[model samples]
Target chain A: MLFFEGSEKKIEVVLQPGQPSLRQLEREYWQQVVAKANATILSSVHNEECDAYLLSESSLFVWEDRFLMLTCGTTTLMDAVVSFLEQFPADSLAMLSYQRKNEYQSHLQKSSFEQDVTALQQQIEGVGYQLGYLDGHHNYIYHLDRPYQPREDDATLELLMYHINGDTAQYLRSDNQTLEGIRQRLNWEALLPGFLLDDFLFEPFGYSMNAIKGDRYATMHITPQENSSYVSFETNLEGEAAALVLNALLKTLQPDSYDLISFNQQLQLDHQPGIICVDQATQPLSCGYTMRFSHYLKPPSAERSADRLSL
Target chain B: MLFFEGSEKKIEVVLQPGQPSLRQLEREYWQQVVAKANATILSSVHNEECDAYLLSESSLFVWEDRFLMLTCGTTTLMDAVVSFLEQFPADSLAMLSYQRKNEYQSHLQKSSFEQDVTALQQQIEGVGYQLGYLDGHHNYIYHLDRPYQPREDDATLELLMYHINGDTAQYLRSDNQTLEGIRQRLNWEALLPGFLLDDFLFEPFGYSMNAIKGDRYATMHITPQENSSYVSFETNLEGEAAALVLNALLKTLQPDSYDLISFNQQLQLDHQPGIICVDQATQPLSCGYTMRFSHYLKPPSAERSADRLSL
Candidate 1:
């Protein structure tokens, strides 16, 4: 199978008070926006507080006053961001943040992080910083420089796992795998808990899901290709709830390395026997939110047969 | 120290029969060409058969009727190629070959391999092929498709080593190291016996050298940074002569992994006790030249403390 760029481009924006509620926008309109990035909205689900789209590439979430859209592959995410920005007045965006994680094969990408930031700067003023090392698991973050107060409840946690191991990863690559089988394998009842869920199993090998409960949302995307397996779990859940989910996934996936990124949340990962922190950075974003990034890896000395997959 | 982009871009071309000899070109002219790529020609050495230039970024060698230029860093080697192509008559080129190895940090580069191929195609018609997996160590090759015969002696071998280890690596990285000290550390008298060598040692860390014996040439470039230590050895010698040099360097460097690329040469690498071939590919180009690429690694199970450096 051809290698897919599993790393994602993310854009999150909180609209000004006078702006129209993004949730009022129709599904067709959102589809058009997704299409700009060369991706189609496969399906979507809604709850009282949000609409979650399962895209051909990744996912999109829209709330009353804020929205988050994420995409992978060679999708021109900047095109979608530029299109969305053009629809509203420049001043309509109260707080905006753009983030990109380093990809496995960056040469296949159409635009670099610098190019994306350049495109975003044309529409709005922002500050950009790179966290971690360029040659390793790192991230590029850009946020609006204007002063704006963030909601106390606004928080997000992202867990990106790489080189997944064990029977679950093998099961994911095997044939005869069903959506229900994957759900049971993931044990969402224990991990996600009390949430309306929607997910899809891609042909060949891959998986994606979106869940919503009350005003909080969570999404997961899994790429099980042997050479570059990656799984990303993201949520607005906070504190112990988020930590429990993260720990459960770690136990199930058994990734060789993983990165944890949190926005407006102070996340503390307890020391695991074999796992070690490789690098980390904490930055106060200009958009009135604090961002923390940490990369942890199972050292080769502690490696098991399953965790020794070559990258 | 900043992580220098160790991967290189290489271009080789043969001029038509009636064209002016490139050797007649003055150092000032070649300096201008190198300048276009944002690199300075540090020093140069010349034998009766060729003029070898040790560039700040990489190396360049000019022969009577042909020339080869290889550059690293974020240098725009395409700009230099375009400038050189513009100087000659469109039909004055008999054969041209351009090759680029997959870089460790391609996002930091100014142009992709495809972009370079497009730029080359603008000057002359050619065929291109990718030799290995994009997510792994690979090479992109483009050569003129026009009818032309290669010299019986025209052969090149490239040994690209990664994650070098042991005393040599530590010595290279240590402060207060001098050119004579590095030369002795590399044991040029043993590795490159009977050859006249010109070498340079970078201020903080790094080493480069050019050697010539009669008409044949060999060059070595080393980047000794902790995160991405790399050493490349290339020569125009054939068969056992090339293999001997390759084995000697491999013994000294003790790289965790390496790639062997040869043009117009059939290289046979004897199995070492712990090293194994992970992936390989062989392709015949339209220019009537055969190319072979092989990637070898010392698996983690056999890893020594020296070979266990994190990539």
Candidate 2:
């Protein structure tokens, strides 16, 4: 059972447009922080004033004001988070959402081997972290202080990660299919229309592409190693286009199996996303693509007001 | 994406029970050969005269006079194969159906860093080898010499491998349920009655179990690491009972999505086992387990007589 992680640790930092470092010198400071984590910025793009950096492990997106940083493998993201805050003391940090898949914990701990999560938990003071499987698919998620403003009308964006069939890896390693041919077959450009996309391929076996339109952007990274193979599709847009993007991504990846992990920041307290398995989703819907299971990661309750105040 | 291989080099040696070193002192000599492959016999069985050794990565089954050995990981299984032939020079070697998943090739090359498969291929004289994907899942299988006897009424047995959904991994690693509880809930005893099963739990993570009922047997291996999680169900039995055992195993595993890789060694030219996917199998069938894809590997035809005679 091969499973791929979209990101080992994803930190969502939201800030108002007025912050001094938000617009100026953001790249220089954050690049150093990325270096601190021993990861390389393979490629980057600028759409209007916003930018996206496709890192060796994960991804980083910068809007006009907000910034999203995600890292996989052995990147010391927690330590980098400490560096980011120090370099750019926010006028006011609205919310910080930090999440990591359970398997990548070993990678993170490679450098910080002497210290476990308890010590990292101490590093994350006021912000409370919940560590457990999210969306009920063995993928673990960790959230920090007031990760999202739960809203009645919020239709949260979803990040889908597919464990592509081993054929992708075999193709990458072999010269059977050119990268352009693959992109065309997958409808990569059509999926994320209207953008000058930046794409890159790792020397050994990996593929990545990122694009941005105004402040809304999408990016995909594929690790094609037999031991670590996964195709990740992510976007920050909403409404009808978002659903289209998810479906397009699925069709493009053509994963033998996939797990859809969505963190709905704003779900109505009473609304429940019905649990859908692989069989149910494949019936009337698209090809073999199926939803494994879907559920809120324990909806934030009004009874937890005290918990929010602690932050 | 993570894919697991339970074999690097598998040697299927069929010898008559009258050989010089057929049964007694068989283990002492073979243990040295296994040691050369850098694997240990984790747990095994001694049913009267038959024996089965579950290796660290693969398996070895010795029933009556038929010896089957398979190795995965960075084990030098090819080198061990040569030593095996030297140690037990059989009066007449009926057949050798050696196979390996593609990923394990790199592991075999690790020990004899300077030499490659071409060298080993040359060394394996009198035995023609064919390398390609078996049952079409990107798992390369190598066959040594003539493997099967094609017949008019040959109803060959097939052992299938599926990539289960990730939830099974979470369940295995969970502290929510104990192993005993899981066994009871799975109806473990009913699946294989009348056998003293030997089971072992790999500390901090994995689980494995093997049982021998006379000459017939069943074994399960679970590598529950979140990144590389899979539950493989394999049994060498046939008929309606085999189908029942498969359903029972699927229910016990309850994988969200799985791919069935089967290799039916012998079969009547006109007999075709239906390809059962997620929809057809899971309809009235028990549990939430669903199949991904099933297909017959293009069988080697009688037209390839020259290829057969090349050996």
* Model 1 error, position B303 (Å): 29
Instruction: Quote the TM-score that chain A achieves in each candidate.
Output: 0.95, 0.70
TM-score of chain A of 2: 0.70
Please give, as one word, the docking class of candidate 1: incorrect
> In order, what DockQ does each candidate have?
0.09, 0.03
* Candidate 1, B195-298: lDDT as tens digits: 87889888777888998887788999999887578888889998888888888788778887789998899887764567766557778776767788877766
Q: What C-alpha lDDT, on a 0 to 100 scale, does residue A196 get in candidate 1?
A: 89
Task: Identify the CAPRI category of the predicted complex in candidate 2.
Answer: incorrect
lDDT per residue for candidate 2 within B1-311, as digits (tens), equals 23344324556665544665455655877687778778888878778745778777666767655677766556777677667667555334544444443331232135422132344454442332211111012232333333334223212233333333334445676756566755664456877777556666665655666666776666666755443355555555555545666676555554433334333422122212322232111111011111112322211122111000000
| Tens-digit per-residue lDDT, A112-146, candidate 2 | 22232343444443332222121122333333333
Error of 2 at B238 (Å): 2.6
For residues A1-311, what per-residue lDDT tens digits would candidate 1 score against the true structure? 34677889999988999888899988888999999999998888889999999999999999999899899988988899999999974699898888898887787788987788888889998877766543346787888889888889889999998878899999998998999999999999888888989999999989999999988999999998875788999999999998888888888888877899888998776535677665577787767887887777654442111111111
